[model samples]
Target chain A: GDSVTQTEGLVTVTEGLPVKLNCTYQTTYLTIAFFWYVQYLNEAPQVLLKSSTDNKRTEHQGFHATLHKSSSSFHLQKSSAQLSDSALYYCALMAGNTGKLIFGLGTTLQVQP
Target chain B: ETAVFQTPNYHVTQVGNEVSFNCKQTLGHDTMYWYKQDSKKLLKIMFSYNNKQLIVNETVPRRFSPQSSDKAHLNLRIKSVEPEDSAVYLCASSFYEQYFGPGTRLTVL
Candidate 1:
């Protein structure tokens, strides 16, 4: 079965500090793409970054993630965390062209000022 | 910015009742999906429709069903809802990247 794992349930960081949210996946499908979605309080989840090429970094809104095929990891990172960055982050994997997404248990990021 | 739309931002229903949530996408996408977000924010795919055809049906309860009128519209219906069905239902449409609708929060009491 295809599955995604986000190790941290919650990650707190001071504003302007570096932050990283770990994500790993296990899938039998050969063609797949990884995505990071951010959901603010009372809002819909939106794509933060997406990548299918292994070892290539995909970035959006000051956040970046690189997909490592060998390790089956696509970790999200940001150099300077902002208070607005506090939200629930989800890691998802889409295998082939099925359009089905396997999402990980989200990680809540709380950036304190 | 919201290409995907869902009706009834929130709903409260009693157990064993039936409820339906409507979803529509203006992105002209051929693929639509339904995902359940639990209290712990654990998202799981419930069903997917591609070009008005069922594509992916996860191991969800038999009480749940998906209805597709066209490529842009996908509706979810829960028959005899259970208390455990209380969660956020997110509707999404995608070509390569999925765009989600403002989820409908279901509270089954």
Candidate 2:
């Protein structure tokens, strides 16, 4: 069985500060992809970033994540966090062409101004 | 900005009652999926349909079923709702990256 794990339950940061939400996964499949989805209050979760290449960093909307196959981690990071960046972040895993996703317990990011 | 749409943002029903949630996607995706988000914000895939054919079915209860009229629509129906079924039901469509619709919150009293 494949599983994703988010170590942090809730991460709070002051506006403009650096932020990181840890995400790791365990899978038996060799070809796997990772994704980050953000869900705001009363909104649907959207794709923030995704990666399938190992050790390659992917960035979108100022958020960046690098998938490291050796470590089995794809931690999301941002240099400067904004107030609007507050949301529930989920780390997902999908194997090959299978569209079904295995999601982790989401991490709620709260940015305070 | 989401192309996927779900009807009835929220629904309140009683135990043993039947409930159905409708989902439609205009993204022209071949695959549509149903996901359940529990109170803890843990998401789990319940069902997935590709080209109007069932492809993935997780170990869900027999009372739960997925109805897809076509590639753009996938509806979920619960034969007899249970208190444990009270959660957010999300509809998504994808060929690779999934696009989600605003979830429908279900409350079973």
For each candidate, give the TM-score of chain B.
0.99, 0.98
TM-score of chain B of 2: 0.98
- Candidate 1 residue A52 C-alpha distance from true site, Å: 0.9
TM, every model: 0.97, 0.98
lDDT of 2 by residue, B1-109 (tens): 8799998899999999999999999999999999999999989899999999999999999999999999999999999999999999999999899999999999999
lDDT tens digits, residue span A72-113, model 2: 999999999999999999999997678779898999999999
Query: Every model's DockQ, to 2 decimals?
Result: 0.88, 0.92
Candidate 2: pairs in clash = none
Candidate 1 CAPRI assessment class: high
Mark the 10 consecutive residues where model 1 chain A has the least summed lDDT: A94-103
The all-Cα superposition gives candidate 1 an RMSD in Å to the true structure of 1.0
Clashes of each: 0, 0
**Worst 10-residue lDDT window, candidate 2 chain A:** A95-104
Model 1: CA > 4 A from native: none
Identify the runs in model 2 with alpha carbons over 4 angstroms from their true place.
none
For candidate 2, the docking band is high
